[model samples]
Target: MKIFKRTKIKKYSKDGRILFTKEMKKEYTILIPMMLPIHFKFMKNILVKHGYKAELLNTSHSRIIEEGLQNVHNDTCYPALLVIGQLLDAIKSRKYDEDKLALIITQTGGGCRASNYIYLLRKALKKNKLEHIPVISFNLNGMEKNPGFMIRPSLLVQFVYATLYGDILMLLSNQVRPYEINPGETDRIVDKWVIKLSNELNGKSFFSKRNIKRNMEQIAADFAHIPVKKVDKIQVGIVGEIYMKYSPLGKNSLEELLAQEDAEVHIPGLMDFIIYTCDNRITDTKLYGINIIASFLAALLKNYLIRMQNMLIDAVKTQYIFKAPSSFDHIKSLVKGYIGTGVKMGEGWLLTAEMLELINSGIENIICTQPFGCLPNHISGKGMIRKIKERHQNANIVAIDYDSGATKINQENRIKLMLSTARLNLLKAADDSEAFLDNAQTR
Candidate 1:
């Protein structure tokens, strides 16, 4: 006779939030929500390199929203609803073993609803009887701790470099994609670099400054070499809540739609947002007399990130075909009169700064996307627009609110109207230039 012993299953906690134990790290697959596709792809690769089996959820289906609305309150921030829904949708699909899975969500540890999403997700999981699956909060601040996952110094460095690389690739690709003589050439280059960079990040030269510079230069050069048509196109800039600005799923593929409308899209890179967050830490100390030690460390991190950004800019400057993003200092300076640095809720003053930065850079047409009922974004993003237009008369800005109920057709119609106005401005400018030339010739 053989005796069999059954393994014990842990009971749920009162709050349904369970800690991911170290033993779970071996068998659990962590699922990450997709935001900035290229960036998340690199981030996922970094996690795999560090011995975590990770997957970036890129599923864009109606059910994701449905699940979110069902789980979360409809009046909550749209981003919270969508993110929760996406995670739940994946779990219900039963593709992975429910007991052997974990979900990771980033927390800014700010005053925004984003910080509360992890708790909301846990509640939703409990509602669906899936509370056994642990949720990991991936944040720089010590907001939450997990035994299974830890971001060591080496891993953090790789993630930072990954972001820098992703930003450069996204910037250059956006510049060339609309103008490429051969369709798909720009994307092919992007795909190639993503894989090469992922492999290099796992190798010995990952931390080598020389190798990093060489990679950036090569990426810029490759994009520059792509055959492009020299035709005028509407230059549109996107600025708003972090997720809505970058996530194709969040904004209904705003970038792709702009390309179809014969427009060049310029999005402020993720590095700027990261830098802004660090700057806020310093701002807190100055404005509210917070801990000076934390402020000092924040300054150090901010400067380091600025140096990395400068390296990217230098590489892009070497290629005359692409226009690199402005430095953080330049972007920060633009918000001088419009908003104060002390406004640190949600996107805060950074949203206003990005809008001003876009207008000053000849990208006068802008789309400020935000979740419906998100008060902070409204105050900083849409509220600052009129003031910006008052100063820069040429600035054309449209604020779009994205919620589950917001129809795609209505949104597209509004954008099409904005595009019409942009076209008129372009034509008027060209005519004015010709008249000036004629007058000079007559003189």
Candidate 2:
């Protein structure tokens, strides 16, 4: 009568780190946070094709910010705050089956705070007692293991092609959309390609090297033919931290604002950043004792990406006036003394190189954006400004800080002031051109 049977107790994760289950394969949908709408739309297709219901949380409304503030620390980085907020807002929206819903966040597995966002997101999910949901860290580093969404060779190759496709799409769209004869025609062409490429990738063996090359050439020709109404619009180059440089929300809709003011926007391809991060592993091995195999692999992968990028750039050059971006090594050489590869704080010397690339390409007006109190940005961006300006006299560089408290009007006002100076110079140059032609005619 005194002997009692022992009971086994199971412990559940309170931090939303639950492993994705087999049942989730049937009904659960994966929610991915969006940085660029076009890129994520294509990426979403790839995920869905791979036997998962993947959706992009593409909203950038106030509600997202509100949800993020409630769950995430205010002093944390803005991109993380926005991303967490968007996901939490969706969770609390009462639209999805909570038990069948999981989240996928990109974990760079880097030295930056960005790599910790998955943990932050998990803590938030747990606080709301939604820890039963799975969190997948999307990365190539193989740092953190997830039972769900392993990257097979085919899947990995598809993703690399997706990145290359997104770059070409973004490059063509940004350059063409601003100067198109018919409003939204460029966007329509982009949407057409998005659907076409998604369908093409759905079939096995569709991502052949020959097919990829053909796709790039066709896309370049398609966008190049978009009837552009040429005007004396200011060409502005945007260089910033990875998030702010690309994410519309992270920069408070900076590209839209620039477009509204009739400025041609140029952003370096996302592939460069991917290559830069991979190259960092090699740099680390040299400086900090990673394995030789890892270093060799990193270098090999870096070179492969360059070949892909060069193919895309060559395709575009064949059809359009667009200038191809320099290789990673070329970018590094631009600021070799000013900053080093190991200075990899928030974009580090890459930010400096982008600015120089813009100036050399004749896009003299530049906007260097950063989150307020981002020390890496302060060190790499603002620190090297004077030298950049010293080298290029015509460079009109303005560094803008973005934060929760920063006003859109304030940021736009600063840009408007810069544009005012730019317009005057443009007009002066026009007058000089006419005068020189008249003198030549008289002679």
Candidate 3:
């Protein structure tokens, strides 16, 4: 197979629309998947502010899965299917002119299927008779530079900020909700803040780091009064590819299901991705004979990410009280031993990284969610479960595969069985410990 390193073609034509333009009219629409709901909204508002019209398609849950199976290879990763299905669904909507539509998805250019997702999405579109529609693959590496879309540096910064915000909020909400006095208050709070911040970010002046810090602080302060239990509950960690961890659609809403089961969810937050990306750059330097400067750059980025995560921890501590067992140092320790840096980015090594972190933190039970057909996840997730469990006898793990053809009730039943075993083991351990203490005292 040949690899292409060039950016967008200098000249291209699709549906009679020429590539290259500073101005965008209502004629073109950009479509994105559900994981980027907030992102798409922010982009839409910003694009409209910049005089371009943007529309978002509602593509998530079973709809994305069904579309994926119908259009894409069953063996492909779920992200590819969901994304492709989203574009196909949008094109079929007939709300937008077919010739004026374009689909957009992030391209990380890593070793995983994610690198080929754009091409797959394009093929799916062409097969569906939507060949004229353009597929815009966004990459920081400048992989694609069509005139129809250009991601300004400022816009990228805002997108990063949005990811951090979304990730942190999701983390806090998961921890708070299981024990909240009002069951849905945390979710309501998240909704309120998402709207507030989305509107604030739409402005020209609110895109600075200083402002982002202030907003993070304000978000913490806003819901500071929500009541939560001070006692410890069963802490269950979530580990898998990035999508399964972040997007409910990808994992079949596994986090919510765990919360409903009265378990405190503890998945490593998004700041880890920043650390992982930096680490990858250093790895690239070693592999490609690049400069040591990449390693230095990675160290600098790690320091900043560590500092940011510390701030987030501080804020979360102030608002929602839950056990944070390991510091960044402890969590970082797991990254090297379990999953090496050579592992492809975005969910491959990251999932293994999080699983190891959870075990190190004394989180004995974990639910590893993988898309039904995601290959890398299968290898790193269920593939290594036996080894992880062998190392830690108390490890209670279950792997759930999500796809359109899968039934929800059946998935829940499997998780329930795992939870039952975990609970029983936990109770037996406590009893044994108490018995040993009593016998020692009597002696």
Candidate 4:
């Protein structure tokens, strides 16, 4: 009888970075940082379906910030601190076996400091004497690689669809939640679809075009049918650093705070950011004569993503009650004169464009959430606010800075002040409408 023996896998790469091998994939649980809760949940499900043990860390304890401050430098951006802290706190919690754990952090591959977060995380791991644990760089631009964690073409497509689904769900639920007659109907619908879609995504026909379209339409219809007492509420749009805008822990539950203040929240979808990143590649080639192949590939990917976005918009349009998201092209066009596309650091001109889109869409009450020490966002976000208001005098924009030192009461108070102005605007508009109706009736 002939027998084959398994060989031991190497633990570290030549560069000294710990490697997550195929053998480890069987036993290790990959912990992902929470960014967009709904989107990440869908993504985590996709990862699980592909035979990987994945867990989304939802722990938002005070120790997370404490851990981040202890390990990461204080001057670094707030998002980085929060993320690193959350991961380290998870490791320290002893909830999972340290030897059987790995981490995944996204790299934008841009000039932004986010690209270096993985290295920072590794350094922190070493400082904490957990250097043996592997960290995976989840990026599109081939920034890093691991045998156990590869994003296959099929997986990438599923991720795209997942974002599309998550965006629509988030958009519809936000619009409905504030107005729904039943307290939690919107959340119930959201929970139901998250499970249903997750199951479908795991199946063989996960990528079926017909099913995707049908599911989107069905989701829109479900939210549309929720009985809402539609009254004029201050429509608030949030645009800022990606993390602060999406992550609840990062923003101190800004969305919930706005809802409590009797405002409807509108946040641009993740796909827009993805598309913006792709568009930046093309922009680089045009302006700086960068690699033609990279630009061409970016253009192709951007077009494909836009096509998917259009399908999502069409699905949302199937229900008239909910306003469909504007096309990314439309958003890009809005920033032509306001900011140059070359300002592609951090959120870049996309931040400026989102504010413009929201203003034009009549969500004039804007909260531009800025993280501490993120210069790019400050430039594109807070810097452009004055220019934006110069054109649209009705624009009510508040730039709130968030960091460990920034108190929630201060942030909420500023938001409250903005809401106060929004309320005055709302009443004035109501009075004007009533007077116009009275004039019409007399005539």
Candidate 5:
């Protein structure tokens, strides 16, 4: 028997010099994936306006998957495959000068396979013989320093609005788009406001305490005006790995798939995950002997995020059927008996808390989607399933494993079976309501 020998990955020299040269700055475009389209639009605009070129890579063709399969291993998580694939495929397309190009990928710098995603991407680029293309890690912690790229305070403020606004838009759009009486009206409104809000977020004056609060209120009001029709539809909450939770590419157009199933989708906003990630830093300080400065920043971010979430909720609840997100403290409280907040890896305690949040909110049908071999999801998701189900007997929960090797049909079939159970429960509840009404009328 002959074992295939794997090529040893070469390490890049750590001389603190950026891979992106100053000469390439004028023409170099950094290619990144689209997790939240609206947020990325705002972010891309900010990056470009600051004398850098940033492009959101999304190809609606089958070649996206083909490129992923060709370069990455079958056992890699779905998002990693698609992201690495999207980058490689775009590079091969030769739309830009190979010499003047770079790629930006987010490294959570947490305890997951994702922290090493850059290494895998480097390997893939090497295999494709595009080794000259620089890869940058877009993280707040300065994991990989690049002289060509830096996060300034002004840009950070814009990103704050980008995230808060994106969260507001995402939260409202999910509710509006599915039920809007006028086809495409929801999307039209969302697009219109994203541009309007992006413009409002540009100036220093825009970030003042008064203006930020006003903008959050106004953004909520704008989404509330999207003429939505009240309809009885099965509301399904999608909670899982951060990427799979929101990214269409990662989850195979899951929101659309639910729409086809006549289900109203409820995705916890990206802000929740962002807050969870930030909150983990504070938790990390408690866990290990992490620095006090890191703890202070994390706490500051956690507070700001909580306030922003509440502001959107208050403004939107006046007109729409919007449910404000739970506070970080509340989410942490959720996992006390079932799991610990200490289980902070991958989606960690946040995944369990999200499921519990959805269950409590009457959106009992849930799909906990995770990539195969994702240990954190395995522990926090499937591991806590029994505990969650024991508490909520009517919870129609399904955990779907997404891997490169998993077929769409097979994955969908499992979802269908879960939905079938959900439909039955819905019918039973309707019957019970009708029976009670009939009995009262007879009396």
Candidate 6:
């Protein structure tokens, strides 16, 4: 028998994982930015099931912002710097294997720095001596390529289940906290439910649309079981660019902090965008009379989503855990009134509409998060707070700007102050209501 000589394999670094060069031998790893918590659970499970080592990086609220200032250009939007800075930190962390990891970022392909963020991240990686790292851009518009990161039908179903479940938990927790008898009870429930749902997401054949509805109902029922007193709770509305409104980093963990302060947060659902996109088609027809069939179909899709929203609202209210339907139109009106319809970034009207809906639904306190250098949000976000306040005097609206150089402590303190005012207002109202009731009963 002839002796075979073995050649040594060369090692390479990707996002932050070990990369093997030989076919069917190299282990692949991917990183998805933490925009939504549910994404982390769903993506990690799917990637692992497919024989890939995937992990999500915990987004840094304080350090990432500071690191962004140190590394990124000062002129870039705060979100851009924070997101890139997060990836940079990940590459340096011991938790991430530097040889075979791939960095992931989402691209909207809009007229904003968000679109250019992917490019900026690449340069930053190169500067940090991570030049060999691969950055994956996740987009519906096909922004980048990584054939290995395919979303199979089964995976997509699970992804949606994860998203909807997370949405429900977020919505329900916000609604329950203000009325809960014990402070932090709602948060406790949320933490518990997230774990439960994460496990449920791992199960096969439980991802049907009907199953999703049942899961939501179960969540509502569980929340209802919580021993909360029926005290009038202060309702706060959060509306801004999609990411800023939903992402912890963008808003500096605004929602969680609000909950801690015993305030109810009403965030407009993502379904609003589907409806708004459809409306654009109808508006186009009215303005130009061009019968674009595709536009009309898009509008139909939005209508379907609106119906879904209505159904969700009905289900929640029928269970009697929170107040009835609150229109998200206030966000739109605020946007239009402040910046006009001319501004459009990832569907400009959507942000505005969400704000308006929250306000109209009787949740007056609002926070609009703006990226420090984001032109559209500046025009549409900061510029409109004053007008929104003027129109609704009770509207306690604050515009917090996120940037690389901005201090997290300062940002949080400012929000803390706003929340303090809300609590005071709520107390004053409760005192007045009790006094009024006493007088009425005596009379």
Pick by lDDT: which candidate is best?
A: 4
Q: Higher TM-score: candidate 2 or 3?
A: 2
**How do the residues 166-201 of candidate 2 rate in per-residue lDDT, one tens digit apiece?**
999998898888999999999999999999999988
**Candidate with best TM-score:** 4
Pairs with backbone N, CA or C atoms under 3 Å apart (clashes), candidate 3:
none
Candidate 5 clashes between residue pairs 3 or more apart in a chain or in different chains = none
TM-score quality measure for candidate 2: 0.93
Off by over 4 Å in 5: 1-18, 438-443
Q: Which lDDT tens digits does candidate 3 get at residues 337-356?
A: 56665775456566776787
TM-score of candidate 1 against the unseen true structure: 0.96
Q: Which candidate do you rate higher for TM-score, 4 or 5?
A: 4
Answer with 2 or 4, whichever has the higher TM-score. 4
Candidate with better lDDT, 2 vs 3: 2
Q: What lDDT tens digits, residue by residue, belong to model 1 across residues 1-443?
A: 11121123333335555777677788789999888999999999999988898989989999999999899999999998988999999999989987788999988888888889998998999999887788999998898888778989999999899899999999999999999999999999999999998988768898998999999999999998999998989899999999899999899999988999999999889999899889998999999899799899999999999999999999999998788889999999989988999998988999999998888879999999989769999999999989999999999999999999999999999999999999999899889999999999999
Candidate 5 C-alpha lDDT tens digits along 1-443: 11121112122448532366454556789998777777788888778777888898766456878888888886777778888888888888979876667999888888788887788888898898787678888888778866667888888877877777777778778877878788988788778877776676557766786776777777667667777777767889999988787778778777778888988888887777888888888888898868679889889978987887777667666664676666667767877788878888898998999999899888899999887768888899878888899999999899888766678898899888888888888889889999999999999
> Candidate 1 at residue 36, lDDT?
93
Put down candidate 6 lDDT per residue, 1-443, tens digits, no spaces: 11121122333345443233333124546666666665456556655655666677776556776667767898877777777877777777667666566777877655566777888887787777775666666664455545555556677555545545566676777677677778778777777766766666556536555655666677788888888777666778877766777778777787768767767788766555545655666666766787588557756655655655555565566577465444334345555545545446654656555556667777777877877677776656666667667877877878777765568788878777787788788888889999999999999
Cand. 4 Cα-lDDT:
0.92
Clashing residue pairs for model 2:
none
